[model samples]
Target: MREMVFEILTPREIEAKSMETITKELGGRTWPEPEFSIVKRCIHTSADFDYADNLCFSEDAAKIGVEALKNGADIVTDTKMAAAGINKNKLTSLGGEVHCYISDPDVVEEAKSRGCTRSTVCMERGAKLGKPTIFVIGNAPTALIELHRLINEEGLRPALIVGVPVGFVNVVESKELIMTDDMPYIVAKGRKGGSNIGAAIINAMLYTMGR
Candidate 1:
């Protein structure tokens, strides 16, 4: 007969153990610690280890995100789901809040009038906050496109952008557009990201600031 063993661990302990397991499973493959930890956390959230390769950073992506958090930058998301997923407690501690205007009446009316997606109108409205803002777009490529337009054409500057919208249409192109800009960004390349990944990336940065 084999003996049965039961071990209990706290949530933090379990999270640490999970990261250790993810690191060990990667074998010889390595990324810088900050980026690796972000990817590892994404895998931990979605159980999709392929993120280890799919996630891409723009050299100072982590630094920019962490600095934004520390500076109390407001965060905007294209979807309410992503907004809900963000750790508001951590962000509040940093004097920031998660915002999503997708369901606003003004956004809906404007999108209808313009024949564009609500995400596009939402970004247009949210970008006018005029504060240092971090945009974490997950489900809508159109939002990303509008953000790029605002930045390039309308001259709206964001603190940082975490663009990882998942879909077949314009998703790849929108992300590509962001990469061309000289803004700080953290992107999950390919067509394999969603609102959860976007929120996970934000939470990972918040954790970095001990938030």
Candidate 2:
């Protein structure tokens, strides 16, 4: 079954789209960090709002940060949350805390240059297991219904989830893995979204939490 899915990208298309979006976002400026480009695109693609409003970038920390923000997460996961084009100041000014989760000492140094104080890493924070721990599984072949089963059986109902699984990855299956109580949820047209789409919930949660 795994072999049957995700054939759409054709390798070249993925590279083309990824590169195109990366270049557009960069606008001739060299990427601060190459890996972040993937993070930037994922956030931009998944999020449902214009960064001009309330927004925050969780970086690879999307799985945990996404849920946290959904539950009033004022703490952003990355120090470059501002560069991601999310309205970082708006949320901060409103008293939302930004949790910049960085693992690399070099990245931490870079984050300090970017004016970051609160940050951590997966090892520091630990593997966010159970049902509610996000995982940002995109474009998985499984549908929302079955995913919900895992959530129900495993008892992983996170505070908020922006399940916008796209592509051929098991993202869809992962997306459906939460919300047994009709919890706050946001989803995009399958294959029409990405990880950052979860930012809307993050912002909303921050707004509510700060209020």
Instruction: For each candidate in the order shown, give its overall lDDT on alpha carbons.
Output: 0.87, 0.40
Model 2 worst lDDT run, 10 consecutive residues: 118-127
- What lDDT score goes with residue 112 in model 2? 69
lDDT of 1 by residue, 170-202 (tens): 998899999888888888888989999998988
Question: What number of backbone clashes does candidate 2 have, counting pairs of residues 3 or more apart or in separate chains?
Answer: 23
lDDT of 2 at 103: 44
Alpha-carbon shift of residue 36 in model 1 (angstroms): 2.4
Worst 10 residues of 1 by lDDT: 28-37
Predictions: Cα RMSD each: 2.4, 16.6
TM-score (all chains, Cα) for each model? 0.94, 0.36
State the lDDT of candidate 2 residue by residue for 69-166, as single tens digits.
44434432322332243446655564444333444576457546756322322212212332233322222223244335444655545333445444
